[model samples]
Target: MQGPARAVQPDEVLKDPQLETRARDLSKDLRCLVCQNQSIDDSDADLARDLRVLLRQRLVAGDSDAQAKQYLVDRYGDYVLLKPPFKTTTLVLWLGPLVLLLCGIWVAVGFYRRRGAAQGETEASIPLNEAEQKRLSKLLANERKR
Candidate 1:
């Protein structure tokens, strides 16, 4: 089995506990570009390590959490944020799943309605000719006798 994935390295940790905490919190919100679904804090990629170091450096340079995040956002676009702001540029990311689900539901309803209509048309009784009706009655009589 592989070893556990270590997120923060000992050397990358800030001397100040408070600053380290802030950095950790910030890291959790930042997305790892290499691992799109994982936060930088959770990723073991080199880029994630660099981002963690960069974040700590920013904190040491007296940049607020917001400012540090904005710096990364400026470089990487809103995709760097795990919870991206709902804006025109990112509209599709926010709404695409909902739109697709609604479209699928609409399609399924249409399919079912068409199927029901087809069944209804096929199930409509056709008037039998006299000979066929006589034969059907004879079959029913035979069934009753059995």
Candidate 2:
């Protein structure tokens, strides 16, 4: 059985089959304000239902699909769009992850380089003096006694 939250409702169905189809398609492309992650069509929120009705009204008023979508986008901003267009305002949304990844890689590389330099300094070819060798031997002898 279909769940209570079906994408389209019978009561909201349009008389014109073609317009109904267009409205359904448009609804699927709209993000639900309340659900955030779900399309308006798939969401059970009251806001989603209101938006669906508004979409149908636009279609019934002879608005083209593009016009209707633009109307909603203008009122709600690009957040209402399920797939936002790549425009100047949304450029950061599209590239932010790549920018963060590159930054993380740069930080990791610098950390490793500094760590390697420290390691190289500690592993240098300097030889220990005789006094230091004798101190080490004395420490080892004390350890063995303990």
Candidate 3:
């Protein structure tokens, strides 16, 4: 079952189809401040509605799509963008996961290596068969006798 649909309201639709389409495309790239992960176009939160209306107003006011996006970025910072530009400020966001994965892989490799070495030592220390065990016992007995 799906949750209740929460998207653009009737009042939010632009009269111009082209402008509406553009607004929709732009909205998809914009993150809803309230929902964080959801695009404004997909959110029904009041803030999302406000952002949708603001976007349409910008388009109707003869702002280019880039200008409209930039205006929002200026107001909300790059967090408003779903795909924020790669920069020093967002370096962690882009690279943190990869670093974590590499660290995990390194740790796993080290653990396996240590485990294999321990197992190898354990195997080498054990007598392989009854004859080997008897030989080891004789060697120990001779050493004690000496």
Off by over 4 Å in 2: 1-5, 119-146
For each of the candidates, the C-alpha root-mean-square deviation to the true structure, in angstroms, is 5.0, 6.3, 7.5
C-alpha displacement of 54 in model 1, angstroms? 1.0
Question: lDDT per prediction?
Answer: 0.90, 0.89, 0.91
Task: Summarize candidate 1's per-residue lDDT along 1-146 as a digit string, tens digits.
Answer: 12223688889887787898888889989999999989998999999999989989999999999999999999899999999999999999999999999999999999999999998888675678899889999999999999
State which candidate has the highest TM-score.
1
Q: What is the lDDT of residue 125 in candidate 3?
A: 88
lDDT of 2: 0.89
Model 2 pairs whose backbones collide: none
Where is model 2 poorest over a 10-residue stretch in terms of lDDT? 1-10
For candidate 2, lDDT tens digit of each residue in 55-142?
A: 9999999999999999999999999998899999998889999999999999999999999999898868667899988999999999
- How accurate locally is residue 95 in candidate 1, as Cα lDDT from 0 to 100? 100
Q: What is the lDDT of residue 93 in candidate 3?
A: 81
Better structure of 1 and 2 per lDDT = 1
Q: Which tens-of-lDDT digit does each residue in 1-146 have in candidate 3?
A: 12223698988888788898889889999999999999998998999999999999999999999999999999999999999999998898899999999999999999999999999999988766999889989999999998
How does model 3 fare in lDDT?
A: 0.91
Weakest 10 consecutive residues, lDDT, candidate 1?
1-10
TM-scores, one per candidate: 0.80, 0.71, 0.76
